[model samples]
Target: MGIRNKLDISAYFVVGPENTKGRPVAPIIRDAVDAGFTCVQIRSKTASARQLIELTGQASEVIAKTGKSDIVTLLVNDRLDVVLAAKKQGIKVDGIHVGQTDIPVDVCREYLGPDAVVGLSARTHELFEYIKNADVSLIDYFGAGPVHETTTKPDSGLDVDGKRITRSIEEITTLSRLSSIPVVVGGGVKLADIPSLARTGVAGFFVVSAISEADDPGHEAANLVKTWNSHKR
Candidate 1:
């Protein structure tokens, strides 16, 4: 509850060794945070636990160096074990972001304690049902969408029919209005989508390759932040 009340999710950057194109992840994290990304999720599908722990440590160091560590939040994607290991090692990771199939939200909240921020992912078809059935008090926010198709997370937002679902601005707006938890949209999100997405009254928008694979990560991150700020409610 502590971090959730003050969480600034305006520009959330999701990055990892896989997201960066043969580039060092720490520098990219540094650039994104320096450029105004308020939250970061360390996600990877290939790295081992020890490697993730090391990378999380490196990312924490860079965020701290930016001098905005107090305002910026760092989280691990789908890995409560990594979050625990990182914290045990003295790295300042803020919380965990789990997918529908990942560790359960209550387990995450129980393990991380009341202060930790726990995020859950949901697709459009299930969005309403989830809101009605889920213990909303256990989750701090919802991560929804693939505004467009993306290779970074190829199967994101796939519906029960197994078809890729691109959430429309209208659907997003409605979800934001209906849910009590903050919602952050991502998956193939581009610079052009920021203004409209921000105006949808979502807590924020997140990106993967948009910044991680950009020619100038910092400049791109800054522009995303600026676009969001210009239209955010």
Candidate 2:
């Protein structure tokens, strides 16, 4: 099966820098996986291509040691080159995620190949509609949110037109109904908000500070996953 098909995308999703709370990438990832996260996105706003690729290599090693490589998916944020470089180094990078100003979805799919799990971030239903109508197959899923305001990525829901669009529960519900692929909500998602967000019918939640800034990522991840699973439709 392809990486997209192999993934349980609805489970907890984690994104981070090279270090989480001063800990290295590999150990944090291992803890997250052990605690039940199914996806990890390596996001470095300032790292060079070489640095990102090295991080992927290190993270891949840690993931391999767990022997759950088949189950977990590792994606790089907005760096197609890093994904390709990691592959050249024999790191099993599953995919790439692009935003509105990054590489277009079709080009990303072309570079990464058909089996790779390409994701797009969408803050508005209009953008989501464009993706759905244009070429749904080119993308695997949508990262939909800033369900609440966030400091994690301070500019998360800003559009190309320079307007901020925070997706309401009703808006999320509408988008979920319209799209055939899974929609995972992120941004300012707290444990207490899971039950309410789950009721909107999204497939999963993406978390940054909720896990990365936690006292124990594994314990926090476990709690988030438990909350999500418990409130399923």
Candidate 3:
């Protein structure tokens, strides 16, 4: 795999929050993309593998029609089968995210190859220690933080909102300084809070509720993009 085949997939994503909260998701995704989100991660918990495949297929069409660049769709857990299924359909998915219990990075890469990205979730300081000690050959980017007590994933660490961002920022800053890859901060990253997080030198974020539940997803997405852009620079 080479750089030419790889995608620079770093952006705000509105994923699954609408349907998870009993609201429609398609319109929200459409609005979010219209609002200026270049990429949106398609993540849905509680759905079976079959259901997820169908959902990703539908989402693939919507995103393809919009002409956004980095459509880095990811599976929540380390489900290589699902990722392969989605990729087999020629979908624009560029990455797959794995949790603590998911398969290790080497196996995922062997199945998906070196080109497709693999995102590892790291929440606690102890987990950060492990990531720091592990061989950097397997991983690509780090998805750090629930950054808050979110109803989305109950098992997540740190119940305090915004504070997780601080911890994730501190960790990712240190990790980024040491590693060649980037670190992405996920969980409870509100549109209003992106600026603070960007200042922490996080590579990007994985957001669901903020864009999925915003009053105006389009404007909310525009705000998220504009804010992150200004802050990152």
TM-score of each: 0.96, 0.92, 0.82
lDDT of 1 at 212: 97
Badly placed stretches (over 4 Å) of model 1 are none
List per-prediction Cα lDDT, in the order shown.
0.89, 0.80, 0.65
lDDT of residue 223 for candidate 3: 82
Q: Which has the greatest TM-score?
A: 1
Query: Tens-digit lDDT track for model 2 on 1-233?
Result: 77678766766555557336666667777888887888888998867899889888877777788887888888999999899889988889999888866988888888888889998886454656664675677888888887877876878777769777787888778778887887888888889988877888888888888887788888988988888889978
After TM-score superposition, what is the CA distance of residue 231 in candidate 3 from its true location, in Å? 1.2
Q: Could you tell which candidate, 1 or 2, scores higher by TM-score?
A: 1
The TM-score between candidate 1 and the true structure equals: 0.96
What does candidate 3's lDDT look like per residue over 1-233, in tens digits? 44314444356574763343566666777776676664555666667787767666666667667765344343434567777888888865665778656777878888888777677776464555766676767777677776666766656664235233335556656765655567777677787768777777667766777767666677877888788888984
Give per-residue CA lDDT, model 1, range 207-226, as digits (tens). Answer: 99999999999999999999
Error of 1 at 51 (Å): 1.0
- Give candidate 3 regions above 4 Å deviation: 1-6, 17-20, 69-77, 158-172
Off by over 4 Å in 2: 123-125, 160-163
**Pairs of colliding residues, candidate 1:** none
Alpha carbon lDDT at 181, candidate 1: 82
